[model samples]
Target: MADPLSVSANVAGLIGLANEVGKIPVNYASNVKSAHEDAHCLQKELTALCHVLEQMRSLLREEKLQGTRFEETAALVSVLGFTNHQVNELYKKLDKLSIQANKNKLADFWERIRWPLKKDECDKAMEEMRRLAQYFQFSLTAANRLDFLSQTK
Candidate 1:
């Protein structure tokens, strides 16, 4: 497995990014259709990350990293702390945001608020987001190879 700490930080980052993508207000949206598409992509990525977290937690319980480098472990600790902060901040922002669909009982309200205007711009942004996520995954996997090699010694 990859350095769980590095993956954890990126997972946190992905959480924040996914939250932002998921909550893009209707007034701020470029294209409603693309927003929906992005939401689907983000949802899938979040689900995968959740599984990764669970796996890492399970493995750590079964195999203690007694031989791991201290510096790497320290970095992971820092990432976990920062991830904690990121989650809290996201919750606070979500709490403060009002959803009019609740009182209006309007099904369409959600659709409106979710997708704004400027369709092309929205597509581009979504594409960039996907690329960034892929980059993080690639890096984590590469690092994991190193981690796996170390374990053999």
Candidate 2:
């Protein structure tokens, strides 16, 4: 098995890519291009890392040796924390975004609504906006729903 710190370090690197993506100026053509390329690269790397993590998790689950301490495993799990509440909130947000995306997909919606928009440009803008809105809504809904559940309990 790989050192716990190595797994943590890789996770940190993946997070760093997310931070960098947040900082990129999406309004500028060149910046958008750069951000897209960076995002694609990060996605590839993170997917590979996810496979590695899954394998490690499976190994940990399969091992049933007597007297095998679980403190390290517990600590590792803590480091990779995302509670059930958080996941539930995320799902809600995704649902909302999916609705918004459907709305944006209507033909001539942007032209009839927003100003100074070509059909192609409007479609592109709406597509990107819908994607981002859904992503954010998912995160927000997940967090809020989890919070609500906790409060109720």
**Every model's TM-score:** 0.41, 0.31
Model 2 lDDT per residue over 30-105, tens place: 3233333433333343344344444443433442322344453564444344322232332332223123333456
Clash count of each predicted structure = 5, 6
| Candidate 1 structure quality by residue, lDDT tens digits, 60-138 | 3334543443343464455545544544443343332234455555654664444332457445444544444454455
Estimate the lDDT of model 1: 0.47
Q: Give the lowest summed-lDDT range of ten residues in model 2.
A: 22-31
Which candidate achieves the best lDDT against the true structure? 1
Best by TM-score: 1
Off by over 4 Å in 1: 1-35, 63-73, 87-153
Worst lDDT 10-window in candidate 1: 89-98
